[model samples]
Target: MTDTSCIEIPEESSSEKVQQIDLLYKCISKLKEADRVLITLVLDEKPYEQIAEITGITENNLRVKIHRIKKELTEIFHKYARL
Candidate 1:
């Protein structure tokens, strides 16, 4: 989650599922190994401690990484929304 380009994808359904999936594919492709795990844990709304446990990263490190990921997602959304 350190890319600052990942968007806050919705949980609700829409006719644009395919399009959203495409976007997800593109964004996920750019993530690093650690970022991918962090992103999934976050999408599942897993708690901080859980994320740390699952990732084997310290909670403080996880928090910083999550912040970076959120920033990356924001940038990605801004760039891809027009696509």
Candidate 2:
């Protein structure tokens, strides 16, 4: 977090707000579906075994994917911050 920056969203109606949220989902839709799945499970604080069972993936693979997703998110933020 930095005091030198801030986020400002233009005032929008409720419907517009939903549209804005959908727009973000749409961007992720273009990304690998696996990453989306990883995000969903990780956000819920699910254990690796649970995520694996839900996704039918091996636990080790799930760990690798989660790590990759963290890196991906970091890059996504960096990409936006530079803009």
Leading candidate by lDDT = 1
Error of 1 at 74 (Å): 1.4
lDDT of 1 by residue, 4-44 (tens): 56768668577588878778768766778779879888888
- Model 2 worst lDDT run, 10 consecutive residues: 22-31
Native-structure RMSD, model 1: 11.6
TM-score of 1: 0.68
For each candidate, give its TM-score against the true structure: 0.68, 0.61
* Candidate 2 structure quality by residue, lDDT tens digits, 14-81: 99788756655654555588799777778779988998999998999888888887777666645654
Candidate lDDT values, in order? 0.83, 0.75
Over 4 Å off, model 2: 1-30
**Candidate 1: where is the Cα deviation over 4 Å?**
1-13
Candidate 2 structure lDDT: 0.75
